[model samples]
Target: MKVKRSLIAEIKNMILQSREQAIRAVDNTRVLMYWNIGKRIFEEEQAGKERADYGSFLIRSLSEALQPEFGSGFSVRQLERYRQFFRTFPIASALRTQFSWTHYKLLLSIDNEAKREYYILEAVKSNWTARQLERQINSQLYERLLLSNDKESVLAVARGEKVPSNATEIIKDPTVLEFLGLKQKPAYYERDLEAELISHLNDFLLELGHGFSFVARQRRIHLDGDEFFVDLVCYNRLLQSFVLFEIKTHKLTHQDLGQLQMYVNYYDRFEKQEFENPTIGVLLCADKNDAVVKISLPENNRSIVASKYQLYLPTEDQLLKELKSELDKLDDIN
Candidate 1:
């Protein structure tokens, strides 16, 4: 006799879930074991602080003994990593079960405690994969936020203690678009860039910052018998607002800002619900003049923003230069 299909489906699902849970259990145990090892090693190292190379000697001796029995997972390199992990996060209770050793490996690389904490919060909150977390770290997401916001605000936002009031609080000024796979120094039209962004919508949304969801591409509107098309539309749930994006493959002009302002106004006036906040307009431009952008918008403007888009990830030298410039600007403001 044939069994009921639903019964078989249920059994299959149960088997899959059990397997997943078992895997998780083993991985969690491994993480705890490593933490214990690290804690012990750290205690020993601290006790021998007077010996200049005691820490190195301890790790090398431990690896030589452990690797032959338990495989290369306990190699010298990995032992050092485990020790560093314990040093980075001393509280065992604070370790998240959802994170694998790979996640800790990435987090261990971050030197700043606050920045590491921010990444940890975001990773757990977003349920980011190891690769996604690595990409965000490589993109300098934390440093970018520090450029615009105070450390307290950024941490508060990450920890759910405060709501973001400024668009710059969530939106990165110079958004990285290296995942779009567009060639650098190559001329591309707005439509071409739009197509690529849509093709890599996940990456685009990731770079777009938090709480954004895709709404439409080429959103159409009619105003007093005139037709207008917005390049892209998104909704930010955190802000409870519609986000209209206008793409420009050239340097931003006052006229471009004016066009984006009109789109934002239309959305606010017609599309946005009474409970929702005003629409936000952003220009994804290849280049922008900060002075022109400031003067083009009203002094109290919060709805319209201009953000430059980079085709490639900023090199270390480039990031240093950009960060230095932001610091100089802050000094001038003070």
Candidate 2:
């Protein structure tokens, strides 16, 4: 007799759970084994302190002996990494079971203690795969946040000690769109950019930062006899507000700022619930004049932001230049 669909699903779920648990158990065991090896090697090295430093010699000999007997993974470089891993995380109790040896290895390469800790905390909270962790590090997500936020606030958010209260806390300027594979030099229409963003919505959302969820594209609003469409509508659960995005293929103007302000007001008047905060409007433009933006918005404005978007990742030189420029602007204000 054929099994009932519900019963079949239950069996399959049980099998899947068992497989996942088995994989996790194996990974944890492997991590512990490597840690133990590292500890043993470190202890042995300490015992021979009177002799000239022979750490490299010791690891090379160990690799040759272990590889011939056991397997291919036991190379001198990997052994050195394992040794460094133990040194980095000396206390066994501090090792996270959620992280595999690969995760720790990648993290060990990071020289900054605060940044490493932040990545670990975020990786655990986000349940990121090893690949995701690597990608975030490569993208300099932490450094990008540092652009707009104080170091203390950035570290606090990473540690999950403080929740982000405003849109500025989460939004990134010069948002990277290299994933969309659009040419940098070609002149593109706003609709083309919007379409590409929608097509690669997942990457776009990841680039958009935390707490954003897609709501609508070309969201329509009617007023009297006129109709208007917002480029994109998203909600930020953390901020508890509607976030309206208006894409501009050219430099931002006073008129663009006014249009976004109108959208924010519309959402505040019509869409926002009593418990929800005010709507936020973001103008994602190719370029922006800070003077024009400051003059167009209200003195106490917290609801609208204009940020540039980039078709490619900025080079190290470009990032350094921009950071210096920002610092200079701060000095001028002070």
Candidate 3:
């Protein structure tokens, strides 16, 4: 007798679920085992306080014995990592089952306690794989956020302790577009940059920070027989407003800022509802002069912002130097 298709589908689903659950159970067990191994090594070292200077010899001896019995994973270097892991995370109860041993291993490489904690929280919140976590750390997402906000606020947002109220809180300057796969040399046009960005819309949204969804491209506006086009239009759910992006391949000017301001005003007057907040306008350019931006916008400006965009990711040293420069400027102002 043949089984019904519905029953077969149900059986397949049950098998898939069971397999997933079993995999999760095995991974959790493996993490716990590593933690226990680290804890044991730590306790044994503590008991031999007088011979602590022989820690290397101790690890080597242990590795020899364990390797012969259980195989090659317990090398001397691996034992050293286990010992350091225990030192880094002393409380076993604090370990999160959601993350695998690889995640913890990657996080252990980060020296800053606060920064490491922030990455852990963000990784969980975003449901990022280990690779994603590594990329974010390498990209200095934490430091970039700190560029626009205080350290406390950035950490608070990552930990879900606070929510951002304005676009500036989440939006980053010098937005990275390395994922677009565009050539840096030969000089690309504004239309080419826009096309590349649209082609990689998902990456663009991710780089744009949270809560943004694409709405329109080259959005057209008509006024008294005159027609104009905005490069990109998006909506920010958290801010409850439309966001207009004007891309420029060259340095930003007063004219660019003025055009964006006009677009923002147009959306605020016509497209926005009474319940929605004011529309935000972002001028994405290859370069921007702070003095020009300040002179173009009103002293109390909050809606329009000018930000530079990079076709490639800056090196770690480059980003750190820029960060230090910004901090020094803030200090001088204070």
Candidate 4:
């Protein structure tokens, strides 16, 4: 009797499935092999009494010996990294299946246990790549969280027990723009800033905090036969809305608020989907007029916000002062 066509297809699928299983098994084994290598290297370094110097010497010798035999993947620095990897994450089972060695390498740079755990949890939860994880770390995601939330809330986010409650949880005040490579001078064109932001788009998005994805730059909008351009447009995945931005080098003005409000309204009416949250307009200016900003929009306004940008990260004292100010505001009811 001849085999049915379906049986042939089934047999082919079985072969493919076995091949896939073998590939996965090999990959897992390789990961385990590296883990063991790191463990052994760490132990040997400990045995030598001077752990750091011993580890450094061990890696150098191993690289010199292995590089000739094994062409690549045996650099002294990489060997040290593997050793540090084991030291940083001692629990083998805790390693995420989705993360590569590169992710671990970036994570090791974080010295604080809570901060490191936060990045690991978020990276695994959000499925962030190595590059994304690095960007967030560099942008001081942990510091921002610490500034805005209590210890318990920060821990909850790190342990993946709770998501950020609102935009404010994930967002940071005083966005940093040092990566744009712009001079901290008096005169700069809107296009110049736009061009630099585009050039350093990744860093900008990272500094913007979680969930922002670039949508458009210099987005042109027509209003009652008058043409205007919004400096930058981005969509926040977490908020599920468009974030309209207006860039200004000088102090934020009432006119800037009006223009941003118009852009937000246009997006809410025309561009945004019905399911999306209301468009959020952010005025990024060098200086902010708090009184002017407060009165420019309605008291019930939820769609517009004004944020000041800084060329550099603030000092610890300055950050502490800002954090205290924000916390104090929560107490002012009258």
Is 2 or 3 the stronger prediction by TM-score?
A: 2
Clashes of each: 0, 0, 0, 0
Candidate number of the best TM-score: 1
The best-first sequence of candidates by TM-score reads 1, 2, 3, 4
The 0-to-1 C-alpha lDDT of every candidate, in the order given, reads: 0.89, 0.86, 0.85, 0.78
**lDDT per residue, candidate 1, 47-152, as tens digits?**
9999999999999999999999999999999999889888888999989999888888899998989989999998887888889999999988888777677889
Q: Write the per-residue lDDT of candidate 3 for residues 11-109, one digit (tens) a residue.
A: 999999999899888988987887789888888877887885777778888999998888877999888888888888888888887887889889999
Best by lDDT: 1
Task: Estimate the TM-score of every prediction.
Answer: 0.94, 0.91, 0.89, 0.67
How many angstroms is residue 195 displaced in model 1 relative to the true structure, after the best TM-score fit?
1.6
What does the lDDT come to for candidate 1?
A: 0.89
Models sorted by lDDT, best on top: 1, 2, 3, 4
If both were scored by lDDT, which would come out higher, candidate 3 or candidate 4? 3
